[model samples]
Target: MLATPVVFIFGRRFFISAFRQLRHGKAGMDTLVALSTGVAYFYSVAVMLLPTFWAKKGLPGHLYFESAAVVIAFILLGKLLEMRAKGRTAADIKKLMGAQPATATVLVNDQPQIIAVRDIQVGDQLLVKPGEAIAVDGAILSGRPLINESMVTGEAIPSQKESGDSVYAGTINENTAFTMRADKVGRNTVMASIIRLVREAQGSKAPIEQLVDKIAARFVAGVLCIALLTFFIWWAFGGPAELSRGIIAVVTVLVIACPCALGLATPAALMVGIGRGATMGILIKDAAHLQKLAGVTDIVLDKTGTLTLGKPVVQEGLWLDDDRDINAGYPKSAARLLAAIERSSQHPLAEAITSYAISVYGKDYSKNNDIDFDHNANAASYINSVFLPGLGVEATLGNDVYYVGNARLMAEKNIVVNAGSEKDVSPEKPVDFLTPMRHDLTAITSFLQAHTTHTIVYFAQKSAKDNRGTLLSVMALADILKPDALLTLQRLGHQGIGLHMLTGDNEAAAALVASQTGINRYLAGQLPADKLAYIKTLQTQGKSVAMIGDGINDSAALAQADISIAMSKGSHVAMDVAGMTIVGDQLSKIADGILLSRLTGKTIRENLFWAFFYNLIGIPIAAGILYPFTGFMLNPMIAGAAMALSSICVLAASLRLRYRKLK
Candidate 1:
């Protein structure tokens, strides 16, 4: 028939591949189709050529060429659909690989020259012009520009980078040209690492898949044995008509017991689930993590960048000397001096002070003689500027030395603040002229206590002739929480997931953020080791822990948790180690991801159950076991169509995951 050529054209590869597998003694799902269809087609040709011989045995002498062709056609159709779905599942890796630039412009003998990205090496100086993607991870040698790192960090806002700050490949340089010294290239780049992670994850077999593979391996052999047994039973136990019935029973068992549905049970569901997560802005690094996410019982969140906006702003300030009212901003001259010192530092706290100072007093005080503030342009005039790590800034402003830091820095410098006309000063430092009257100490304490949740930065000054400094003023800075943080936490709690906040911030600030976000428990002032230890303890208690954070300090904890989540705007190290990255930095996506995981898991279990359940009941019926009681037998042609229907049903069940509501 004309249909034979069409079937052969599409199904030739399946037959050849299956034959090769059988000859090598490694039978797969293809082998079952090849054996059943090959027998049916060739036997039908024999019956058409020699009808007298089949008539002698009282056989039907009917040709079943169409049955064989239809089976191959149905199978080929299923394969085409499965292949398309598999490609969509791995599209996330393609999106990530596309981000890397193909070429880079490097400085050759101080002149810009274009070269392939692979040709660029470490220590090479590259130029990233405005709107151009960075070619490699490097440090800026010169030029200050705003770089859009959303490609890597998932943060929508462009971050400003000055000279000596680090820039990564795939990030766009905005509105400026910058020269950078490449530190990593090619496979060593962060983008390359992300691509590799996604590929490995997609290729990795989930734990359930391993179980299915084990069952499938033995399934084909069992089907062959059942078909042989069905043939022998019909010939040995039945009357003269059993000869033709025996032949039909053999083909029926093999056709009906096709392992296609069983083999596709896990992978089909996994492909759809992983692909859906990518589209929803949740990048699942691997299928293993997808399986792990649904089981997470406890979620640990970092405070700084995860719950609250990382940007700190000045809330309030008060001068130690009552010369200016506390409700008003710092003294104009002191604010100018503080801004100048802060402008020289790159700390977030320092940036807050500088912004506050510029708003309270103009950027340049000389523009208006009415105010005694100094210009920020003279910020570089200070000498011996040292940025004490985790403390504050120390710089010289004219003939006097100034210190802008926290209470701990003031104590370390031995700056006395007590209730006396002449405070008890350290003998090693000159502090005879300074005094902390009872009223002034009471006022400072009251103001600081009132803003217990704010980060208070002290501004102190001393004459160059003296080693000690007098406390001039204090500024309170606070980082506000994200708008959706409260609702996201409440949703997670309602789902029975325990919420715990782990932060490096002080207890008071952490407590305020926790209360506002509706999180009932937290561990403040926790280091990376402390977080890792807590996750380990939770795991020991049979709780699956998920840690969400966005800094280098969080990388270790992320690696330790059952599921690690990172914000889009968080540190590269944290995202790299995390199993899931929320592209929009929304906490609600975590809940959505968990919901999708549970739904996908349920679908896979249903697929697997139907696959096994169908074979368990279908195989015996096809073998003619019901013929003795009901006199009903599964025809070879009907068995082929039923087998194809089972596979289509499995595919349809898996596709349902694609439409499940994430919200």
Candidate 2:
């Protein structure tokens, strides 16, 4: 009776919460705890106060006040341990938050002023000193800094940054000081987006957890019914001390059955797995998407931006007929015209051509040229410039039309490409007029095409009489492969995943990348629709497809795939449509993410199994099933300890995922 007051006071929360849940026609873990301890406490009080009343019924008046107190103490201790373990699961979020400094040095009116990070505004020029964290996302205006991007990229090597390069928040300026124009401040920074994504992913419930919740909802009520049935069986069948045995059985059954473990099985594993992924620069947007990543069978990769570096550079340029009268001042005039036409388009190849022209003919080539071409002074000199999606660009310059694109685009406009000595050579047909020039162009075209894997671009001028343009020059451009492309593909292939490459590039370039990467199957000349259709076809074959891309054309295909991955350096449209984003634009993270998903899935299954198995064996023994043979009956205090240990076991299983290697 002395221990009753202390037990009631310390465990009041359980009783109060159980009462509230009962009022709403629901029950939970609190309900079972309250019923067991409440029954034991009140029954002991009855025995202590009414000794004579129990003597008449041939029963000993024993007080169980100590048992009730010890049970509450054991449960509280278990809860404290579980809380500490759960805190460790979110340590990654804390580490990421710690990466941001509280204050930043801003260049206010040509002088450095220290200010709070939250006070930073867009377009503000912030100065970052050596060995300091960047204030926010911005582009470098001056000074090249070697930045340590491991906070965002998970790489140890510092990246070399120059003028016009972007720097993100939380990155360390390892080498030199630089001034930057802040483009994204506060919540608009990339680190802020990564934090938001990681939080959402950790908080989300997997599909399996939804099923567990439904089972756990009815679990408490079912355990209550079983406890009541155990009481009746003991009261009727117990040979001696039936009342004592019956009350003991009721307390033990209610205390030993644990619903907490069942509730925590899936969510605990998901939290630890997602938190670990963030540390490796893998931002998982949702738990459901991470679950889907494990079962991906075939992975469709985009040629540019995903596997190869998206930047294309000019390698070689050749003039078709240098000795012809019409080709006088050929190279210079052609370079200026090509620059003017390509400057109007937004394609990467167009940018490469424009840069090449500016480098060869100087930025202000019109000042020294005799031709009437000045792109800056007379912007309308190149008029009606149209960008054909899969073809090239078409523009008109001073009554002479020009075509700059693939061979197919040239053929569509009836332009004659006189390459090689054969009659039906290559995709473009040769004209019979310039025989000697054709032989020279043929040798050059054959050498360029056969020697290098670079993409070929043709420059042609239209004729007024035949309406067929003459091929003026050919330029070869190349997009280099990523450093980790081959290794990443090899790892994914070893894991039994089928790899396929899709691109809008021509057959020669596509074949070369495929062969170099050891990919067996590839398709070239694939437009946006063609890529989308390929993904759908793979899905129709009962194959789970994962698409990795980094362009606006890849948006539809990214959305259509079962699992879509995007490079952080890619276009916004592709990233917005993708389910997962690989930071640092590293292809190897794709394999790491898949391996993490498999580990998380395995952990969740083990947790669920242990939860169900514990309850199946524990509840019966607590109800005096063993007393019929060896005379063993579980004490209420021991039952409480066992229940607490079950939840701890589940948490420990989940925490194991944090330490597992993701290679």
In angstroms, the error of model 1 at 496 is 2.1
Q: Which candidate is the best by TM-score?
A: 1
* Candidate lDDT values, in order: 0.74, 0.73
Q: Which ten residues in a row have the lowest lDDT in candidate 1?
A: 366-375
Clashes of 2: 1
Q: After superposing candidate 2, which stretches have Cα over 4 Å from the reference?
A: 1-206, 210-225, 238-252, 315-350, 354-435, 438-442, 451-455, 458-473, 478-480, 501-542, 551-561, 571-577, 626-638
Candidate 2, lDDT over the whole model: 0.73
lDDT of 2 by residue, 73-154 (tens): 6556545433433322254356456668899999989999999999999999999998899979999999877776644442
Query: In model 2, what are the clashing residue pairs, if there are any?
Result: 420-442
